[model samples]
Target: MTSTVGVSGAGTQDYDVIVVGARCAGAPAALLLARLGHRVLLVDRATFPSDTISTHLIHPPGLAALERWGLLDRVVGTGCPAIDIYAFDLGPFVLAGSPAGEGFDVSYAPRRTVLDKILVDAAAESGAEVREGFTVEEILVDGGTVTGIRGHDKDGGTTIDRARIVVGADGLHSTVAKATAATSYAEKPKINAYYYTYWAGLPMYGQFEAFDRED
Candidate 1:
């Protein structure tokens, strides 16, 4: 069972690390940290089995990491097919090849709904306290140092949690990053847009296809 905390009438709780965002990056960090016997608090605004916009492809290196973490079998059990070949259509001709590496031969494209929940569950099983549906409203700063976080549960019950380290694993527009005025380097403007959708009865046949068009 996953361990959760309620903010109703709760006082300030302390932890060794507080991670915001419980998806791919945050969950695994929490899992490994908790496995090292540190008190970790992992919070995310959305609950598990939720969908997010993504390319949804896990390359071989990622699969190998999951294998090391002992979660690859569970992902395969979800019936997500393996992707071995990649084909690119460049208008006049096509380029096709399989991934070439020693231990990196295949990849998997699982839906975010399935992938995120598995990661969160693994973190929880590793003894990281997971708070789903919890929104972090503030990053507490004390004398130019981040000391804690102030957030609320889904029911609007507020709570304050302190930790030695605060991690901002929340995506592109991370609240923690904004709070800390983090700087960005080597960033580029968007040049293209992508549209993705799921088909009910489509099969990929262990291949990934990409098309190039001059715009």
Candidate 2:
């Protein structure tokens, strides 16, 4: 059943689900839940078309998921090149092959600015109430159960929204996870650093390459 908003003593709004973070993970979840006829509220601290550090590689399986969601074509329409070949450089020898599975033969590496906006838009289109630049400050708990969120918008207007379920898709060090004292098992510390840059005239010829160095 669809959620209904009811006024409470705290002036709180209501929804079936409240999704914190509206990027890759949360947006899709919000869209799917809204599509299933549930009232969904998707909130993000940043605005759309924002960039973030990410691998940016969408493999065949990921592409298949987007295909099932009918978003593959939208991503393809962004003019991002398709990657059909994979090459690994081990300094001594190289191994090269194509990634194949689930009837998908190609992958993509779209910029997060573009890809994330598309996802957020999809969630909004699917009837999710999207709140960009909304920072979730607190997760409400009643009887040891997560009930909602207290946050604000860019203008610093505080708002409290209640939900049947609260989702923490805010990535590492999520506020919801911390509020609930969620434990992480088998977690490893950072072993390496990553740096990324864009090139204008370089060509890959549909190849995705990874290099290993001893430095």
Candidate 3:
């Protein structure tokens, strides 16, 4: 029960994999898939140059992905150096690794508006058709497999698209999840007491003393 409202005589005519969310996870996934030569459709409820605030930290594993896509060059080309981790709790703290031994490696920070635009454009250039102001209303399923989805285009009205493999890149509040009930585990909630903010121009060492999530 997953599909898209194929924009009729409008933006991005069609696609093979229609990703619902275009930020964070969805955007990157679409770009990679498109590079592999799939007709990818990238959609987002919000338009680019949009503001998204959070603890925007991508350490280690994400760097590996960037390396795979060869975007590490471009991201690093933006001038943010890799973050050096230093854990601090009781005192000057423990450096995650020896001065020249073990530790995680990753770049510091980049604004969402700046970074996401790069990813968005990369996906589009990779051949994924990216669009904004499109919202998915339901997942179209013909049987057991995810088929396609239906949503509204920016200009208005419902659009329907059928794909062989529909990816539910739409996170958390994903319409695909509710439509198919794909998960086996029950969801849980946690009480968080952290306020996230961005600190540009300041040297950001990974694992600062402020972040204590060992609860």
lDDT of 1 by residue, 71-172 (tens): 999999999998999899999999998865539898889999999999999999999999999999998877777778999999999999888788888887
Candidate order by decreasing lDDT = 2, 1, 3
lDDT of 3 by residue, 181-214 (tens): 7664554586676656656587555443443435
Taken over the whole model, the C-alpha lDDT of each candidate is 0.85, 0.86, 0.68
Q: TM per model?
A: 0.91, 0.92, 0.76
List residue ranges in candidate 2 displaced over 4 A: 1-13
The candidate 2 region of ten consecutive residues with least summed lDDT is 1-10
Residue 7's lDDT within candidate 1 is 21
Angstrom error of the Cα, residue 70, model 2: value is: 0.7
Better of 2 and 3 by TM-score: 2
Ranking by TM-score: 2, 1, 3
lDDT of 2 at 37: 100
lDDT of 3 at 122: 82
Give candidate 3 regions above 4 Å deviation. Answer: 1-14, 53-55, 90-106, 184-191, 199-215
By TM-score, who's the top model here? 2
Deviating ranges (above 4 Å) for candidate 1: 1-13
lDDT of 2 by residue, 24-99 (tens): 9889999999999999999999999999987599988889989888899999999999999999999999999998
